[model samples]
Target chain A: EADIYQTPRYLVIGTGKKITLECSQTMGHDKMYWYQQDPGMELHLIHYSYGVNSTEKGDLSSESTVSRIRTEHFPLTLESARPSHTSQYLCASSPPGGANYGYTFGSGTRLTVV
Target chain B: AQTVTQSQPEMSVQEAETVTLSCTYDTSENNYYLFWYKQPPSRQMILVIRQEAYKQQNATENRFSVNFQKAAKSFSLKISDSQLGDTAMYFCAFMPLNNNDMRFGAGTRLTVKP
Candidate 1:
């Protein structure tokens, strides 16, 4: 089974409330990524981390922020959630470069800012 | 910038039949990776198959296989003996060798009907 995990499989909060989506992996991967997806739409990269203390914005601009203080943990936080932030957030991790590289994705958090 | 395209928004196949989902990508890098992921109603992304750009042979995993045409920049997934459990939204992804970001297509929803 995939080792990546995301907490609060679903969340519903009012606008302006602070929320955090938690992601953790036990596979010891160096690369971790966060993606946002709407129902039946394409996934957009939001944030990614190379390792501890290293995080970068992805192709899509996001109001949320992420931190990677540990290799196994990468968390995304929205200081003040809004209805626009309602979507599914996926977390993934991958091993270093190689011919057979692939990613293990978490179950994802479905957030709904009411 | 690399981009993946899945023209088929949805497709259906009878159980035990075969179905193919089309995917195309644009990239300037010679060395890169392609992937197919499945997301069921549970919202968990599952890795279905992967293909390396340098490999001439198509990648296959049991009933799952890929038709990778490097010159055409096309990578399509063929699912043989489709089962009802195979119903899900499938996404095509691209990852360049230099960067860890994975670009995903709009995705195709596949329904294996009984």
Candidate 2:
């Protein structure tokens, strides 16, 4: 079955360590997004990509950057991890936006930076 | 800018009972979409239901349904015959018809008791 996938379901890293969260969808959706889920269980959009080579930051500002080099892949990278960065990262994808479309989200990656 | 809000921070329902989670959004655009998502303890975000602003009828999926009041800018989710698996953090989201970004509300944690 076609689905979105996020690797490293859980990660623990030291402060200042560089890390990448991988997100890929086999559905061939044109739009993909990354959301940071806080301890309060609220989700905040951090980044999104309309298509390959087109990426933009979302409402929530973050030190991480994302790249969409392939239609199926959108990866988020933190140049240097910090304790404050510890949270669940969720990746989602939906067919080109504008119309009413529901997203297919992947099981998030729980990152804990010490 | 669009903003989504979930008034209830937490709620509980006995198994086989019904529960409603309220969600309100602020948006100037007439054409938009509303969504309800469920995040389980495992942290997998799942789409529960969706409602279109242009449609007068509410959307329903199995035991889940939505009460969409476009004039009031309110969209709420009603879970019928709640089960153990229904215990999770529920989030309300809003997306404009012309905008690619989606705004999510702080979730409401729902616990289904046996």
Candidate 3:
């Protein structure tokens, strides 16, 4: 199993509440990504970070924000959650050198906004 | 912008039989990487196989193999001797060589019936 871990495997909250999903990797990868997926559907890239202090929005627009203050930690937060944001959030990390290998993913956090 | 497509939203195969999943991608860059990731019921996204765009030979790992038709912009996966354990959501993804962002196709849910 990969060293990557995501806390709160499942979450349910009110629509207006602020929420944070935690993602950390012991692999010390330089690149980390967050993807949003509906049940049994394709995944959409929401956010990503190349390294500390370097973050970018993905092809899909998202109200959520992410911070990469540490090489192993990339946490995503929503200032105000909504029902439309309900989805499975996946975290993945990969090493440097563009090898295209070593992409380790976490189990993902399933969020539901009521 | 790079985009990946998996036309098959779902597939089924008898135990011990073989199955193939289709994936196509669009990109202007000549060098990139393709990957197939499996997400099981547990929700952990696992990397199954990967192929480099420049390589002429398709990538294979045990029972998983890829048909990389670069000119056709098609990358399909063939699973040999299917097993019930292989039942999961399979995703096709692409990553450009110089970019850190990876794009994923809508997944194909594979069901192996015994």
Candidate 4:
């Protein structure tokens, strides 16, 4: 089935450690997004990409960084993890047109900083 | 910027019953799209339904449907014949037409009891 995927479905990392959350979509969608969500909370937009080599920061002002070097892969990186960084990171992609069509979301990466 | 709101923090429904989750959004833009996403215990974020701002007709997908009230800026999700699998965190989202910026509301935990 066509879908978006995120690896390391659950992670427990120590503070000051570096980590990367992997996201890849087989749908060949041009637009991709990264969202951060705490348990049972609202999702905050952290980063987004239009296409290859194009990335932009979202409204949430995340300390993490992201890169879109390939059309199917958009990975988020945290240089130094902190307790505040413990949250679920979700990856999604949409059609070229826009949000009129629903988004395809991945199984998300749940990071727990200890 | 657009903001979405989900008033109910938690809800419960018995199997085969109908349940409605409320959602409201604030936007100056005339055209946009609304969506309901369900995050299961597996942490997979899936789209339950979507409503276009310009379309007067509500959207439906199997047991899932949406009540779209454009004038009131309200889009609510209605799940009929709820099952144990329907238990999840429901999120309301808003996105401007042809734009990639999607905003999510604080989620509401929905429990479907057998």
**Per-model lDDT:** 0.91, 0.90, 0.91, 0.90
lDDT of 3 at B8: 93
Q: What is the lDDT of residue A5 in candidate 2?
A: 94
Q: Candidate 1 residues A68-100, lDDT tens each?
A: 999999999999999999999999988876424
**Each candidate's DockQ:** 0.65, 0.68, 0.64, 0.75
Candidate 4 residue runs with Cα over 4 Å from true position: none
Clashing pairs in 2: none
Cα lDDT tens digits for candidate 3, B1-114? 889999999999999999999999999999999999998887688999999999999999999999999999999999999999999999999989887667888899999999
After superposition, the stretches of candidate 2 with alpha carbons farther than 4 Å from their true spots are A97-99
How far out, in Å, is residue B36 in model 3? 0.6
lDDT of 1: 0.91
Ranking, DockQ, top scorer first: 4, 2, 1, 3
- Please count the clashing residue pairs in each candidate, in the order shown: 0, 0, 0, 0
**Predicted model with the maximum lDDT:** 1
Q: Write the per-residue lDDT of candidate 2 for residues B18-83, one digit (tens) a residue.
A: 999999999889898899989888867888998889999999999999999988999999999999
Q: What is the alpha-carbon RMSD of candidate 1 to the true structure? A: 1.3
TM-score of 1: 0.96
Model 1 misplacement above 4 A: A98-100
The per-residue C-alpha lDDT of model 3 at residue A83 equals 95
Q: Write model 4 residue lDDT over B1-114, tens digit each, in one string.
A: 688999999999999999999999999999888889888787678888888788898999999999898889889899999999999999999988767788899999999998
